[model samples]
Target chain A: MNRIAQGLTLVLLGAAALTSTVPTDLYLNWVKPGFGPFLIAAGVVMVLLGVLVIVAELRGGDQALDQEDVVPSGAAAAGDDGPARSELDHAAAEYAGHTGDGHGHDHERAPGVAWLLLLPVLAVFVVAPPALGSYTVESTGGSSGPPPRDENGSSRFTDNLSEAAPGEVVELDVQQFVMRAWVDEERELADREVELTGFAVPTEDGEGWYLARLQMACCAADAVVNKVLITDHPAPEADTWWKVRGTWVEPEGELYDASEHEIDTSSVEAVTDPPDPYE
Target chain B: MSERTTPERGSAPDPATSLGDTIAGGWDDRGDELPPADWGRSSSSRRTGTVWLFALFITAMAVAHAWLTDDLTGQAFLAWATIFTAISFQALPFLVFGVALSAALVAFVPTSAYQRFIPSRPGRAVPVAGVSGALLPGCECASVPIAGSLIKRGVAPAAALTFLLAAPSINPIVMIATAVAFAGQPEMILARFAASLLASVVIGWVWVRFGRADWLRLPSRTHAPNASKWEVFRESMVHDMMHAGGYLVVGALAAATLNVMVPREWLMAVAEAPVISVLVLALLAILLSICSEADAFVAVSLTDFSPTAKLAFMVIGPIVDLKLIAMQAGVFGWRFVARFVPICLVVGLLSTFLIGGILL
Candidate 1:
């Protein structure tokens, strides 16, 4: 019965291997989810092991079955000989010793628990995490409109960037916007041109603007997708690279909106994929 | 069937009885003198030769794999990640523990002491083994050899098997890692705890009821004589390091493959189906075979999946996965692993679903 069960298992494994190909992880997950590659490979290996085990069990059974078929008389006597008897005695003694009382040695085996030390060992290997920064602002669903601009066609780093003294035109560094999260108070910069670098993401609203830009928080898990609303400009192609100088404005709400904000679409330039492409 | 018949057809005395003849023949050749003191030298040398050859082959294959490939795609990444994970995971702390623990057993404690507590009946032993999970803490790599030792010591097979299944899932290290991975989300910890506990208990119960002890043969064969405690410790350590390390490498290679090869955008599109999305994330968890301690971090990063779905993935992963199943099968009997794995899976999933539903 055990042998039959084993064989059945092998057949199942082989069948699974042969027919499945949404990729093993995908297949396994669809059937019974797990960690992708590791789980798939482990499953494949298990099937292989099942095959080997079934073969071994069948062979053992075959031997036992054959032994039963043999006639049981003088044939057995020939097998019991002088030297063989002594060897058997020795074997019995060894087996007896094993079954006897020196189990203290088993206590020695507890050292395997020392591997619990590995948790600390691993902690030492992976680097310490850093603080979350500006690159994450837009992605966090903070502002909803065009980013705020400065006097000289550049977006102001923050609403507090020296207030541009009424009429003085200033060329703001595009990189400085990374330090602050855009808020509604900065919406007065509308029609004031400012340069910026970001990748284009398609928006379903058809108003020609959507949340675009690489999201990053700590690592990438908390990555916030920044919503960019473009009303006046042509619809940017999804996944295309872009360099645009646009005015800041307040736009209507969308997904995960925190501080409702918008962007007045301005001069847009389609560009190539950027080097080291991320905020 | 044919192969089985052919080996037995040789005109030889019953092999067990012929052992005496073989010994006597050796004595006759030596003119009744005692056997040589160093018979082990020849065997050891032969073993070393095999080991060296295997090492050479592995080195050659690794070099070729690194240099020869150019167009790495989805399949390739999967293969590599699996291999890497398997090798590294095996070598990591668990390997060290396997050796150290084995050594401690051999040196400090008497093996027979186990007889005092170990139950003779599978029925009683199975639960004890499963609940023993509360005691030993670590992942599958560390639990296996310990289970093997328990078996060699005459512990009920079902009980030992239960201990093996539960130890990895409920270990403190794994739980803590899960907690860190989920960060402020308290429910993640609860789900993992509940799921792992439930799965372990179910598997233990099944083993007690239907498991056959005769299958635990390979582990018993590991009882070869070497030397002192240092030798046992060193040999076991080296053995586990190589074996577990090999599996870790396989696992990592598989994970890296998935990360680089599969298109994430396509997966995201598929994520629109919430049921499929949860299942997909769970599958990724298994494939990645991240150590239970680290899986939380990976689970947290998957932004597309719902928190409840991700919770299921985290909960189910450590207890059951492709890599763990494969490793367990190798160390334990396939029959045992097969029975245990399914039971655990069902229990783990159910527990996670209930907990996640309540929390999320």
Candidate 2:
């Protein structure tokens, strides 16, 4: 919590931000793609502020002593519990008074909690945790269909599907496919051979598997699972990315409340993960 | 007046000193008091030891990095770490933006400017401040310190508190994001705006009428008397970031743990009940600590919940999430947050039900 520690924490955090954003796609694992510039800007500002703190401390040491003589008199005259003194100042004064004899610098120390900033810095650099995958999908009960339509019943997902010819193999994201299968009035996914890509999550029944991808609104923390239940195919190892050519198998009962949708696959191919993992 | 007029005379030598003099001259009237002298030689030896300690810690972490990553690849642990890191990374830039703005208020903007703009009376000022929250385009992370700075600059505490709650939720970016997330439901956007604004204003009034000044802890001013405004700006920015960022980490950790542990099915199971659904989602909003800009998508995904329930999620999120709670405790004393959060929650839920019932 001393000035040096505070400055170093900032520098390391800034460095972590810079490394995550600048030369790599590491940031995509955590946040959306648009935050790159903001991360970089913040990184620069943080590094600068940190360097300023350290430089000021090193060079202005003597000047600090000169000013200490002036602080207590002004603060005391402001009165111990007067409206003029902030609660923070009162706390600081008590802290200063308690440690006033040995640790003359206690007032300059940031709250001890500031040390916790180092945890994220260490987590980022050490763990380098991967993006959310099948574990998230399986645990979260995998993607619910898209947001409900307006009262007018306009479709948010099937607008582009109108261009697709019947019987053609149409490529779609796992999210788009789920929305069309469940809510689209056109049933654009029905009877069409649709190609989709996602990591695989085995069905709870152990019969087939779900091709799942996490759709993140802002960051991995808010990611929601979107998956297609691929029937009549062997489940791949969990989290393995695949492109599957399949046809939608309409559910027997009501479409809206069903827990999962079915897709009968004609083909499945192994593929590397996409550049942007989340939908 | 002379200081305002002769700005150029001070500019020729040191740009920082001149900028400091011109912008901070108003501060001179407040009776200068330098920051505590402990900032000087008292810590040199301790400083070296601290630096060495930091170096040792980093080296130890580097040594453990491979072993930890290898052993800690369990699914839940990985998910937890990813979410924790994501929340931290996503929130930090916004926190920095808040700190910068707050520091500028302390270092550059004069107290007189606040007096000029805001009405003196807490009742009138509260609503005006609530509406003005639309101007800040960022999320909740940016608003807390900005609110704290406003209080320090002599804005009515009630008004500043109003601005804090209202800014993150009613801001233009959040509104547009809500529109896009809810897609065709224009009413969702209107309802959120109305509910959040009303709730914040009501809470502000509650604070005004019954709130005690002693309960609030204004952020302490820190800078040497003769320090340049740039120095003040830099110092305060660093201090605020270190302070707030640490609490943000605590919030993010708690959120990640809950997010990983709590099953989505439990939420869906209760999505059928009318009253319980609203309360559960409201509580979930606090627990999830999802950013306001993104909470709409999360809300929209919970298609099983009633629209009013979704409205509760959106309205309460920016005002009283785990992260905001942690940051508030750091900025305002715990005494204030202890009283404020419960009242804010109740008012927010009431506003949501009223607006959502009428609109959705």
Best-matching candidate per DockQ: 2
How much is A138 displaced in model 1, in angstroms? 20
Q: Write the per-residue lDDT of candidate 1 for residues A87-193, one digit (tens) a residue.
A: 21232222222221211122112112223322211211111111122223322332333322222222434334456654433333333332232432444444455
Best lDDT among the predictions, by candidate number: 2
Candidate 2 — which residues are off by over 4 angstroms? A62-107, A151-155, A165-168, B1-42
iRMSD per model? 19.3, 8.8
Q: Could you tell me which 10 consecutive residues in candidate 1 chain B have the lowest summed lDDT?
A: B10-19
- Candidate 1, superposed: residue stretches over 4 Å from native: A1-279, B1-91, B112-137, B222-229, B238-259, B265-278, B358-360
Q: Individual DockQ of the candidates?
A: 0.03, 0.34
Report lDDT per candidate.
Answer: 0.46, 0.78
For residues B1-360, what per-residue lDDT tens digits would candidate 1 score against the true structure?
333432332222122212123233222312211223322443323323433443343344334435543333333332333223223423243544553575465445555576666677767777666667767666666676676556655566667766776777767777776665555567667777766666666666676676555444322222224345554444344334333433443444455445435555565666567677777777776665655555665566565677767776776677666667655644443565567777776766676667677767
